[model samples]
Target: MAADSRAARPLQKMFSEVPATYDLINRLFTLRLDQAWRKIAAKECMRENPRLVLDLCTGTGDLALSMAGQARPGMHIAAVDFSLPMLLEGRLKFVAPGQRVGFVLGDVGKLPFREGSFDAIGIAFAFRNLVYKNRERDKYLSEILRVLSPGGKLVIVETSRPRSPLVRLLFHWYMRTAVSFLAGLISGRGAAYKYLAHSAINFYSSGDLSDLLESAGFRRVQYRTFLFGVCALHLAYREGPGNMENS
Candidate 1:
């Protein structure tokens, strides 16, 4: 998918405006649970002790940095984002750690790597943007599969629907009113938070995300929900061609 595409225009414009306060706004909006959630996702990404990891759509590289912090010796971490400003912010954040993770400015639809390049891949809070109402969703999934090694993990932390109706209603109300208001006020990026709020309110349930991943040929999908199920962490594996056929 091109950055200039219609579906991505608002996203591009929104992200371009929020890099300065993106991390901080996220902390406030999620009441700092976002960091803890990322830590859990990072742990799952390293569950197999992958030698190389890719953080896709690594906005400001928070999860990438978390992975870098706990990385074993010789564990290489890399991140990719299409937004130059966001990638620059990620680089600045990496300075304190002496540049442990490689940051690349590129599109997810056309990852700049060879087939089977990464031992594991992780995305935080951005999975919905990749699949929600996206016409080129299959293309992006194909690119992700192209770069992931067989049996490589794809760990994702994303907003999800609550199984409880009451919890879901309250979550949606808070998102629409408080989160959008404060996040937009602090970040001065109302459109971005509007998109964020809308997406979070409408994103897939855990089961739905798992089914989507499996339909794309990933295997053994599992998920854990948190905070009355408003957020979810998923783990899925890339099945090799032979294994995919057998399965």
Candidate 2:
């Protein structure tokens, strides 16, 4: 827990500092594809017809907004992030009158919700930051599984490593050099962008992340790669109570 807190401090501070320019930097860095990715993930979450949805690590509420855009009437959407500034920014810009999306300040690793509380959960581009250590990652997955109802779904959108060696090499070079430099220049937070670039390069591959989700008690884990395998959308379901008990 101490180690986890240590890791989280840096991330929290970085996010808090960047909320003003976070969305702009994201648009620039991803060439506006980040919005499309979040939309795709939101569509997957809604396919389950979830009554209650939680968007964890919902930085600036992009995924939450997407989910609410297509949500059924009376559906509840709660978007949580540790950074209050980011949540506030999202609430001001993305939230519409009478919209279902509710922005909250909270941590994903230790969600402030009851077991079996949510029917669907979505996380975008922020899973890598939760992986402070192996144990920390396990804790996050456990909490996510605990909160999800039986057979509920969790959708994850994140950067991925390519299988091809040549593509992997080029991807790493772009992330480490061009992305880091450009984001830092635009955001005026060079260290923060550098950390993000480093995290992307070191994050798990699609297959390995799917395995991790399965080990955390999720079943029917599958993923779709995009952008020459530089990004992926992972979908996994929590099995019924009997399967979860033995997990």
Candidate 3:
């Protein structure tokens, strides 16, 4: 609650405590733009023509679902998160049977997968919860790169602070007051909503995070800002394990 160095457990506990309403609150807070954002994110990842994908921190499986929907209709996706209840809720969201999505119980920092196993890795609106200053952030990036195949891609979608003063004023007001109020009304967890707002503010900007990705052994790193600079999508490629060493 105080923005400490070790806030992951607190936030994880909060998400687990409110797993039933997490999806509802997410939609309310983002004013339904979250779905569209996921669609765009999925499209961006699919550009690499990845057949196998992993959605890290795939809360409620929205991004994974979008990836499955937007991809070449036969893409295999592993949607993973530590919260089982959230995955359960996501499973029920799909009305039809035989979806191509598989939900796995795992942590993003240490994935239970083999090296070079996936063609693409994605995380949407979930990175800030891990806290950028944490060592786990490095672990997340390392695992991401390790699990991605040669020339694989990693796309991270996160919230950003508005650069325009007028937009910042409106964005802050919406985040602290409107978003929190709606989230509280739907999920009965205004405190969690407040924590989310704080996290967004403290989260790194697109440029800063791109540097982190580069430092983590990713190449061709770049970022795309969206939603009036209130959101960003970071794209980077894994040059295959050991390939960089020889070349």
Candidate 4:
């Protein structure tokens, strides 16, 4: 059996233990830039005026709450995560009046939704766990594609490998050292932060991500870099509704 087959359970357990300080550690590590990044992902989610949006792997619901603030009246948002504690933490911060937001506890590998359910999907920082070295990568990607309506879009904001060698080394060192130590210290979840540091240090580059998305059947993929390529936003499109060719 592939290691990733077992990755899900441990990852779920790791996340469940850190809900209390997850948001705070994020703010500290990124200097509160994560919220801004989520807002960007939220804008991409709403750019096409999607009727239904799904926040995939919505840890602490930050991305969903960001989307709720900008979501059109009557628009529906569904946020899902396997970790119950994370979902509960996110629920406490959700206060978007007149905006529809629903939190569901479930695994991303098997989303409980009909085919072509959401017009758009957004994920923040959780893309790596679903793709990087995950033996079930195809299954998870296919499930995402399955739930997206025709001509729908999938937006992603995630850590990226820096392009420059020197900067990359510096960033990796910081991630492995300061980020790992500080996050563990603050969250009291050393193993989780250790995994976080390891994952981010060795994740894919922007170009690699584009190819991955394209090969996964996204008709088109667009990328934007942030903080000198340390983070990236990916916009992936399904084929046009009704099998029409998108120009």
Candidate 5:
């Protein structure tokens, strides 16, 4: 994937400024439903007893921590993010002694791992950030596919637009107004939160994302919506050999 240094700098700075209150603000914004969402994602990712898991764009390592909680004795989780402050904060707050979750400083578009390294991968709420310019979305997906072992699973948790027209309108309004306002009040970063709100509203639908996964050589794509379709959890698998690229 082509690197966009311009976009990366601002994102790094913005995320760096909020690690202290990131978890608290997220809990407040999602009404604590974020925890349940992570739990479900963890459950889905761990179904195959993956030995090595990668959590991409793992801000504050919430999803990684959730997975580590129920993982097998030898399971190892590598949680990666571009922001050093976020990783440090996550390490300080969530990682306990002997925990297998390792927070790494890295970028999603350019993962630093060998091909077919991870058994499973998970990302929550941070997928939209990779698609800001629309040019890197496919590249990021390809990178994920490249690093995933054959038959490895990918679980994605992201905000989605509701199907009902009324609910969609209200959700958009809340994201653009209430969420931004409250996030600003809590983090003192109104503009950052506004950007986040806009990104979520403009992100592709669950069906579109599923198609993207298929195009990247993933199969058995399935998704479930939550909170009246305001969010979705997508599960997909990288087909074994004789499938597309590996074929």
Candidate 6:
């Protein structure tokens, strides 16, 4: 798909088009670091001790699965995405009934739920993928805020550029060259992998995103960088009625 077309199409369309190859491409492009990143995000997301969790943009339910494992054994998770094909593919992996895990087809930007509906919400490598054309993106962030319970937590896991000059230079070259080539060979979507690398470098820095979270009404936001700053895990909490904990 051309860059413009990929950018213009609805997220569901692109994801469904590539559903069969999504996981393979993801692993190859990330060099399997994606797994470790999700694990860290899951652990942090579980810190709030949520009873019901929401995994937005839950592609193939990888992050949701991790979150489920961290939550209490019977805890329920609402894993939602706009792409039904991707959801179906993900559903085949697990045998969770609605009591434990449930999958829904919905867009993250326009989540279907009520206020303070979930104890925690998680988005991993899915924020940037959202079709944010203009200020419309703010609505998506606000929706997240509205759906989160007071004192609930929001965890984000996404790639970031390394700060070290020499290391960043090498990482950039590898992503532009070797990573794209390997991803193309396996998934037949080298161009998508190319865009993936570009998206990582273009996405917000840990600090910038933390500010966005604050602007969205979250308090006591903090972030942790991993893989020498190649990835970031952001933690933000919805303010409760009482005094908020600084940590």
lDDT (0 to 1) per candidate: 0.86, 0.84, 0.77, 0.88, 0.82, 0.75
* The 10-residue segment with the lowest total lDDT in model 6: 1-10
User: Against the true structure, whose TM-score is highest?
Assistant: 4
The sequence of per-residue lDDT tens digits that candidate 4 reaches over residues 1-247 is: 0012334588899999999999988998899989999999999898877889999999899999989998887789999988878888988886645655788877778888899999899999999999988888999999999999988999999999999999899899889888899889988889999999999999999999999999999977999999988999999988876322243
- Write model 6 residue lDDT over 52-160, tens digit each, in one string: 7898888788998888777776567888877777788877767765335678777656677889888888888887775223346787888888888888888888876
Candidate 4: regions farther than 4 A off? 1-8, 242-247
Candidate 2 global TM-score: 0.91
Return whichever of 2 and 4 wins on TM-score: 4
lDDT of 4: 0.88
- Report how far off residue 244 is in candidate 3 (Å): 15
lDDT (10s digit) by residue, model 3, range 1-247: 0112333565567777677887777777777888888888898777756778888888788898888777786678888877766777777766655567877877767778889988888889987876455657767778878898887888888897667878777878888777666776677877877788767766777788878778889988888888888998888888855322222
lDDT (Cα) of model 3: 0.77
Better-scoring candidate (TM-score), 2 or 6: 2
Per-prediction TM-score, please?
A: 0.92, 0.91, 0.87, 0.93, 0.91, 0.86
Off by over 4 Å in 1: 1-8, 97-99, 241-247
Cα deviation of 141 in candidate 6 (Å)? 0.6
Overall local distance difference test of candidate 6? 0.75
Q: Candidate 5 on 1-247: residue-level lDDT in tens?
A: 2223435577778888888888998898888999899999988778777788998988888898888887888888998888877887778656477676777777767888899988889999987787656577778888898998888888999998688888889999999777888887788888788888888887777898888778777888989999888999998888885222221
Q: What is the C-alpha RMSD of each candidate to the true structure, in Å?
A: 3.4, 4.1, 5.2, 3.9, 3.8, 4.7
Please, what are the lDDT tens digits per residue for candidate 1 over residues 1-247? 1233334566766787899998887887788999999999998887777889999999898999989988898889999988878888888777774458888877888788899988889999999999998887999999998898887888899999999999999999999897788788888888788888998898999999999999999888889999989999998888865322222
